[model samples]
Target: MSFATPSLIDAARSVLIVVDIQERLCPVMTDPRGVLFNGARLVRGARRLGVPVVVTEQYPKGLGPTMHDILSELGDGASSAVIEKTHFSAAAEPLVRQHLESLGRRQAVICGIEAHVCVTQTAIDLRAAGWEVFVVSDACSSRRPESLTAALTRFPAAGVVPVITEMVLFEWLADKNNDGFKDIMSLVR
Candidate 1:
């Protein structure tokens, strides 16, 4: 469990992971509204910057599909690269690895529900599988603050980088003079 990355997150080598932001789970979360809003921001920004995004639903039959609000905002830009899994770790599903491989990305920016469970496990597995994993703290939540805190605290030892939404957005942009800066700035603000 090493927590060292040779360089910063490069968009060309990065993919965004939206995990289990389904209907039932978000509303019951300790910070559902924030999670959805921030998650949506990450998705939108990633799309604008040509970053690949892989969304996941943890058993939609019981939890229902992803929030309609996000889909509506995402509109036609919604990713077809979605994974429906029974496994806590999205990496447990072969498609996820294939999806990331197809994009040729080496880093994953993760956000979504159950910070202490699915998100945590996926980050760990992704790390073990040789992917640089970054978990967006503000864009993730659990039913309890303690649980979320525990996961964030333990992430570093698992070789997962725990970061805030703005940190990811800024790191992705990398330059205020870049063309996408204004758009990403508006989205985050």
Candidate 2:
């Protein structure tokens, strides 16, 4: 089947998935500074739109905790949930799936470390399971930029839509005159 060009994210129906942005993983990412900054801004914009947020830590026991930057922005509330998993794809973890179900979210705007592994797998699986998946290219990283490049190259074939942070925010806002338009535009700009 052919896929249509992805429309803007519907904040009311969308969620943001931050995958494996743990302390140890972040430091080793290809461009930690850029990844972390964009990831943080994504969280901020997602929060402002009142979209549900979920995070996954890959084997937190050995790798380390989710970095403070992400956690600080997500906070602790009904709007966000964090899960720990040994699986690269968060959707494969029972808790993560349950949390997503709890939010009743069908579309996931995803970002994080290790693009070819966790992020890619999650995008593929989530799409296979019938959720719309959008991979936030700029907010995801790996030890080699090649990995991110590869995922961006391959995921769309598996039904994962690749997007940048600004595209996501604007889609979620949809119009400059909407109530949240200015706030999301400020974040995007």
Candidate 3:
């Protein structure tokens, strides 16, 4: 008998996907500030642990670019890619699918805006495509609180694991003795 702990995220096998937390979109979310702060924390922690990141901007022309806070964290030193998408599901975008496939990581750590729309669709699609999907609950939001609740409720049936920011950080770190422990801990603090 083989027991595999699929719920645990390994830094080496993970990719962080920041989805459509765009400029125009942020201000209208149920909890914009909290979402951005937690999303940024995830991005910062991912970089500290050498996890690759892919950021998607949904319909950039209409929605505007990724928020400044998230972009700022990516910086020059971060291993990250930005994809402009029109599809609600980032996984439906050919470029996004290709890029994710190229990374060769099976686990995807996702966070972003419009929880009932883009975020939910992307998580479902990614899970269907065989990626272990973990959506950061606090780092995702919708224009209305109920929509956010709906999205989270749908995750389990979709095979998408709903997780918190700290869960992702610690799982990626896996041990307190890791080199980036102090740096990543600051994000949690």
Candidate 4:
């Protein structure tokens, strides 16, 4: 995947990874509502597109659980694997690696909290592990805007693509005539 150009994120070869959108962490983020709303929407879109999802909660005991809205969107853990971890990067966890290997997908669409920490590290690590990473900017936040900016600035340099929620949805669809177009389009709008 060329960091200088747009890489095709084929749904057939993609997985949606949402990192640390936990209950306690949500309120402290710079764009709490935007992050959660877009993150939840991304989950719905991923399900609609038949893309596997891996959601991680960083120390759920301290962070509280994954937020209600996101958990509800993810459902009763029916389709997505919800992993718990202490590592800043979910990619560093054994379970996350297992999911990635089992899914056998090359592209990862990432959304979550604390852009400068867990989310950024996971994206970088995933890229290093030979996965094409796309970090959804609107769905990521930090307590300070500067931190988000700093991480985003390093994304392309690290070969991780920084994108938005809608881009992932549309790119995964890659066509309007497909069956889930309206459903995915509604989530983006």
TM-score for all models, in order of appearance: 0.94, 0.94, 0.96, 0.95
- lDDT of candidate 1 over 15-122, digit per residue (tens): 999999999899989999889889988888888787878889999999999997566555565453677899998988887767777877789999998999999999
* Lowest lDDT 10-residue stretch of candidate 1: 71-80
Cα misplacement distance, residue 117 of candidate 1 (Å) = 0.7
Given candidate 3, what's the lDDT at residue 128?
80
Model 2 segments more than 4 A misplaced: 1-5
CA error at residue 11 for candidate 1, angstroms: 1.0
The whole-model C-alpha lDDT of candidate 2 against the native structure comes to: 0.88
| lDDT measured at residue 68 in model 3 versus the true structure, 0 to 100 | 94
* Candidate 4 residue pairs in backbone clash: none
lDDT of each: 0.86, 0.88, 0.91, 0.88
Worst 10 residues of 2 by lDDT: 1-10
Ranking by TM-score: 3, 4, 2, 1
Residue-by-residue lDDT tens digits, candidate 2, 47-127: 888998998999998989988888989876679888899888898999999889888878999999899999999998888
Clashes of 4: 0
Q: After superposition, how far is residue 37 of candidate 4 from its true place, in Å?
A: 1.0
| Local accuracy of candidate 3 as per-residue lDDT tens digits, 47-119 | 8899999999998999999999999999886379999988899999999999999989999999998999999
lDDT of 4 by residue, 8-67 (tens): 888899999999998899999999999989998989888887888898989989998889
Runs off by more than 4 Å, candidate 3: 1-5
Model 3 clash tally, residue pairs: 0
List clashing residue pairs in candidate 3: none
Better of 2 and 4 by lDDT: 4
For model 2 the local lDDT of residue 123 reads: 92
> Alpha-carbon error at 110 in model 1, in Å?
0.2
